[model samples]
Target: MATRRKEYRFRNGKIIEIEENHDGNYGAPGQKRIKKKKPTEEQMRLVNINNKVKRCRHKLLEYFNAGDCFGTWTYSQANRPPDMKAALKDFQKTIRIVRIEYKKRNRELFWIRNIERGTKGAWHIHFVVNEIGDTASIMQKAWKKGGIYAVEIRNEPKVYDEDFSKLAAYMTKDEHTKEIKKDGTPAKPRLKETSYNTSRNMPLKKPHVDKLVRWKNEVKPRKGYYIISIHEGINPVTGFKYRRYTMVRFPEPKRKVQLKRRI
Candidate 1:
């Protein structure tokens, strides 16, 4: 017996030839199986950066509720900003020193370092740090790598009045896009490092699913925890849609004891 084959042509001028398998299934041999496309370097970079940004946002929201202050620290020089490698080195040393100094206060400091280009086309570091005492002085004193300029620390407004999403967006704006250097070279290819850095003290968020019915209902206040924000989106990795409810757990409330009266 001779097996019949069929050839199909598409509008794109492409042809697909299919033959019957031994089991009588019609396909191009193993065509019934689905193959996943591998992501390119650029695509991988974008995905990584996006995930980092999301994690940062979640952490920021959590830390802010704990009364942590937010501020920015910049590194610059008279000639130009320090190179990425040198700037990162200085940042690491600065964080180490800051931790040691703040150890006495028993407070944890969280930071995210963003590398950006200044108006003068110089590479500089724009760092966002959680509340720490005398942060400007500590960072300025630690950064001695040269081109040391003023380290400005500006307090962020109240969390309720501010849009936290902008923080992540600002840090990662145009990060995935390709840029051209003054020398007519692609800057993206040269950027082999991450766009941002975070402190090890920062906690990771574990999101839980919420009932779809509660989408429009106000979140109820619990005794030891409260809802910070709710976000709904499709998971890129798993391709599953989910509604995430972010909650901040706090210390247990102190209970009042009543003395019993004797009859």
Candidate 2:
């Protein structure tokens, strides 16, 4: 007994808004506080897994670009000279070739710098260049080009794995893994950030070569940041001798500009 139009009529026997039908939504006139229903356990798990996959993919791609050889760099304090800017520029110039080669070989290089402390204790960048083979040679060239004695050494490294399935599988079905509400329908899993950080082989600690000295007000300005005037132990690897002058323990805040981005 119903016609084509009647078949789509509302229960109240009124024709539904043509626009609402096309849009799949009725423009409700009143304010309605629609509380987002909490996701079921399975939904949450799926979301978490999805997030995990995203993070892993991101990191894997980053590693691929940087060649998975990321680490902080350090040079001998004794090798530091009167000027610090000159040293970094020289080193950068030497490193430029490595960058070029990475592109030539279709590899990626990612450099990250954390709380720099080189010849001048300035912020230094750490990178994971795409090509792994030429690191030693590049460092040697940087040393020669930099003309600075502080050796270029990598420290505190972390590598990313490309195999996403294996990397993702680790978080499967673990109750401890947290989840996020995904944007799309029936939100799929997205891995938690904490889980990713833990599993990605990320370095838990940073290289801290705090040159401490006990010079009473004798702290003098060196290359870039003011030097604490260290009077101490030689590095086992480099075998460079630091002047026995005691370093001034400047408060942590001032240390950055006062003694950052050195070597």
Candidate 3:
């Protein structure tokens, strides 16, 4: 088996994944292949949702950085849309206005949006958008029917790794997971729907893959970068060890000013 590695570089950090490559042929000639059981429908659903979450996280890290805004937007009682369709339409309209506002200032808008309904059937929106000079103000003015509550993303390595993972999980949370209602009774999951959306301006870079030649046993950081986290697991199907880690550049120190002695 050949060792393979993949490297993904983002705006704030980088991820490296390494694993063993198993050839497509499962067995040698005349070898009886064991038939694996097919995945149940529910299992397949969860797998798909998990994949969506990973993809969402990758995009968020690739395009967004510190000082960006991440928050939820809700509609007033009177302005609540009747259905998901209407909610999406209103959201699209609002974003279109936001894009125009950014364009007017010669800034390009990059955003990721997700829409979901609460147990009571009320709809709301979650978003991650690049912060310009007037992002909050523009969004607030454009979304007249709702009040936008936003918080700025912190300038930290964890914000790009752990925090982004949490954000992406929430934004892409599927309706397939069973949950308890407020009444303490098990509630049925809602119908599966779209996971999330990204603006066309987002640019996703392809990861570089090659034969694994370094860091096979120990997770080490590069000269100018530091490791944020490392995860190790075994692939059930392949029975091979898998490892992934994240690295971020060290922040440069501020220049010190020297005081001059007067004669």
Candidate 4:
């Protein structure tokens, strides 16, 4: 943090401008400065683990949203390169029965995939094709009979509120924060590290270089924790003002890129 000293450089008394050093945002921090509280050793380890799990979870969710019946089956061939065409072929074969069954019985159920980086050095799925059936044995037999080892039978564990507990376990369980020395109650909402854009600081209303550009092009800026550029929530539904700054579940890059040189 450099001090802004009022020193006059007089060639003539017109006006000379000087920028404060470092500006508190950019540049490397040397040993003299400490930015934030140093977390405990345990805290750092847990944070690293959580970040990995979160990344894996994103891929898992992507598979489901792309018309996957159960999150259990992976598009990637067990540690081998993904054969999407083969996966889709298998998908078509599996769902043809499902679609036929649906028409006859109207099963509008969605599947939930329980995935983990397996001990066998392959990503595995404990696929429950749909939650609305006792079809575990049926599906397992079908896959084996049709030669798809990737589709396996791993049902919900025998625990109270089986499905709910699993989801809560993932969502609620987070890394421990720095242990406060004195008595400090854990806050209501858990803390999670998020991708923070450097454009987190809001621009003051003096026609800042950023705001002028945003206004001219009429692009929306996102909200919350901006240091440089601005953000406005652009909801296709009720619109930005009615919405809240969304939780950072994925990496959204800060748009502080300068394209002036390219043009």
Candidate 5:
């Protein structure tokens, strides 16, 4: 009765999340509430980054698939952005040009981007944009202030079981390093805020919620769907077992053509 499972179905794959409801009546209405220990700053930071990465990965799975562009834009020392705001402005300028190019061809561009400033003050942008032909060329022309490295999201993945998980993790990584300030004092490690920007045309995916009256441990994929990744974990709060996995259905093979009889 306390178990809830959610299924997010995407074009190429699906994600499953199972959790135990912790809203049960642990105390009576009149009982004084006991204050719980606050989570440390580092713990909170990690949780936020994890949630952002998960959300971004699901969105990637929902709208974009193989052949989409995964790109990194870096600035030269001369043209590097002076601040995070300037970096964002530069990204906007580039995307605006890209959108116009797509519009000229009677198409709309959907993109997700994350910008980060390194500890050494180097600013860069990581983006995943839907490719509708001429994507790489368009990117190269649009972002003139920096070096652009764009590659198609491969249909076959060498590291992860699925295609986009590794890419998503790499793009949303919260890289940080310790450093000493010019004043001979320790400085806060620059943490890449786990956030992303999206084009207005991006789709908001909603998952189907299922309440499992009878819990089943066995997971079986539907016909034509193959399980690619499986993860099992226990909730520290409830001590309940929860598990999730992804199922991907490959494109069906094309039917062979037959030659007409000579007679």
Candidate 6:
């Protein structure tokens, strides 16, 4: 009887051939099989960090869509810009001041802040914020340590999704701040930086997970909270599959009580 052969192409463009003998054996006898190496500790740590960053970005997007997001704004550095670390500190302090003043006026504010490098390699600030009244002027006045600023309210629903995805992609893009040396070691220790920030009062995401049943079955109809989105991924460290649900909880609806005694 003639043997049947099959070929498989991997993502790396490697072609592997397999033959079946009369006895239904796949590989030839004494042919050693190459085993996949487990991920190194450093690699696993990097994977975990990547997953965490992605989840945080998605949560920020969910927060933006679940409620009213005022707009997206950018703040550029002035002619004499401070160091990145110092500039970030000053930026955060200004934001806190803005939040405090807004609250004093009995207005609520929520913000998602992102820091990025501009075309000239200068650090800039981006924010998706919700605040009562006109905030662009206030932000401009507060961020006096920068050059120019712009704010555009997100009008269209489709634009929100597009902008959200773009922001997430930008935040997660490969960072060029660190370089790899020829010896496979990093040239210098990367400076710790906050990629993004969110308001403290932002809604906390609720996770609903079920292995044997669908997501709908696992999540019940809650009064204050509603499901925003669901994401499925494998844990990089444990390799365990999981389904994460992003939920938004609003102020509970008021219930009416009957006056039975009067009746």
| Tens-place lDDT digits, model 3, residues 167-212 | 7766775566565689998778763443378888766677777774
Whole-model lDDT for model 2 versus the true structure? 0.35
Better of 4 and 5 by lDDT: 5
Q: Where does model 4 exceed 4 Å of error?
A: 1-92, 114-123, 129-134, 145-163, 167-263
Q: Each model's RMSD to truth, in Å?
A: 15.2, 29.4, 5.0, 20.4, 6.2, 14.4
Over 4 Å off, model 3: 1-3, 12-39, 155-163, 177-195, 211-217, 233-241, 252-263
Give the higher-TM-score candidate: 2 or 5. 5
Candidate 5 worst ten-residue window by lDDT: 19-28
Residue pairs with backbone overlap in model 5 = none
TM-score for model 4?
Answer: 0.27
Q: Which 10 consecutive residues of model 2 have the lowest summed lDDT?
A: 15-24
TM-scores of the candidates in the order shown: 0.52, 0.27, 0.75, 0.27, 0.76, 0.50
Candidate 6 structure quality by residue, lDDT tens digits, 1-263: 22332222111211111111121222235554333458888768678656555555545554444234433334443433455676577767888888887887888766766665544555666666654556766776776655544445345343344324444534443343355689987765233333566677755343322122112225342355455455455655444344434344555569999777864
Listed per model in order, the count of residue pairs whose N, CA or C atoms clash below 3 Å is 0, 41, 0, 15, 0, 0
TM-score, candidate number 3: 0.75
| Predicted structure 5: lDDT | 0.70
The positional error of residue 101 in candidate 6, measured at the CA in angstroms, is: 3.2
Query: What would the C-alpha RMSD of candidate 4 be, to one decimal place?
Result: 20.4
**Which prediction has more favorable lDDT, 3 or 4?**
3
- Model 2 agreement with the true structure over 15-59: per-residue lDDT tens digits: 111100111121223534333455677667666665565444334
